[model samples]
Target: MVRQETDVTLRRCTECRGYAYGGGPACAVCRDLVDGLVEGAWAVFLRQWDTVAGGDQERALAEMVAAEPDRHDWRIVDAAFDRLVCPDCGGRLARGPVGCPACDLAHGFRYAAIETDRPGVPPGNEHAIRVNVSVVRRPQVTSESEVLVRRLLLPLLLAGFLPTTEAAQRMSALMKKSPPGRRAQLVEQAVEGLAEEFSRTRRAARAAASSPTSPDTPAATRHRSARGRPR
Candidate 1:
């Protein structure tokens, strides 16, 4: 007796309506966002591990993992809207058109359609902890070192080591001055400097956290006191 073969249907992503590969339920973009979120969260966790009090570490880790999805979504939205402008009024698309009603309506429609799919972690501490633990245990390499250096750049900038304009200027100058062969070395050294600065900022933060708080401490400072060791 001959057996009939059955055709299997691939799942389509709800957001993009594309075939979902790798046995995943979502399209590549959505699936990759989940990976990025996990990796980003792990990077943040490693950097800020020393900032959390020993007793509160578990809770802090969970909260940090939970926050990654929203952060990822907002980053996507911000990038999508960046420098987008109204054609008629030439106003920023994010702010909407000032005088052009047609542009304003179009901007509203486009803004409403902007993708902000927040890929999330699996429920429960076990999954997050297990995945991150595996991440930490993975073997390191030169490329990973460079990636870590690159990852620290934004955090360093946000922590205010140097103005963004100056940093960009210096980077441009370095690229112009260095030969192609030496450029990678020089760039790596520069990023390492930024990483060191970030480390110093984290150290200061840890010191502040350990010190007794004053009633007169500014609310802003107190707020930042809660936020790292850079690797």
Candidate 2:
């Protein structure tokens, strides 16, 4: 059989755990789903957070974060997303095509080379069966996304707006929440708060380091400066 020779790759959705197969961006359905989530993200986040945090939302959230400082991931709750279906075979695509029946059928070679006997062949004939190699192409979006996010985080890390790289990561992941106007305001407030705290810590450290040293530091400095009573 002649191969189609079309190059395509599959992408996996992070939020919905769905799969989309194509050459460029993900399928239209997935884009629409994530776009909807991004449009009214702040409200959605608050609603989801409130439900997840139960009573006394702020306190609950604080306690939860304190329990696991590096584990407060955003979750899209109370919604179901449809998995992407392959355009060619009308079958659901798998995330990166591991053990996917449709993917195996569409792109997997599914066979190994083997020797077979032919009718009327010589007594010791050892001919091998012809085999075709098929490679399933998977999207490289994850690594690309990581590099892009790292580039975006560099400025925040240098500017002291974010105290650590991990915090920058979390903030970047949650960037869709605040709208443009609100995003600017929130960023300003956050930077101001962090800057103030950083400045305060530095001042405290300097004061502690420069504090009096048993009333001997000044005397030693003077003795060193004197010329032994002009002798």
lDDT of 2 by residue, 1-231 (tens): 111221222234454333321111334554443334222332454576664423456345433433342232211111110123444445533223345565444322222212233332232121111110011113332343433333232222222223455755555654556675676445445544554565576567557656554343475543332465563
Q: Give the lowest summed-lDDT range of ten residues in model 2.
A: 128-137
Which candidate leads in lDDT?
1
- Kindly list the per-residue Cα lDDT of model 1 for residues 30-94, writing each as its tens digit: 34533453345444444555544233554454444333423332222222233344455565433
Off by over 4 Å in 1: 1-35, 38-163, 213-231
> How high is the CA lDDT of each candidate model?
0.39, 0.34
lDDT of 2: 0.34
Name the 10 consecutive residues with the lowest summed lDDT in model 1: 1-10
User: Against the true structure, whose TM-score is highest?
Assistant: 1
Candidate 2 Cα errors over 4 Å, as ranges: 1-162, 213-231
- What lDDT does model 1 reach? 0.39
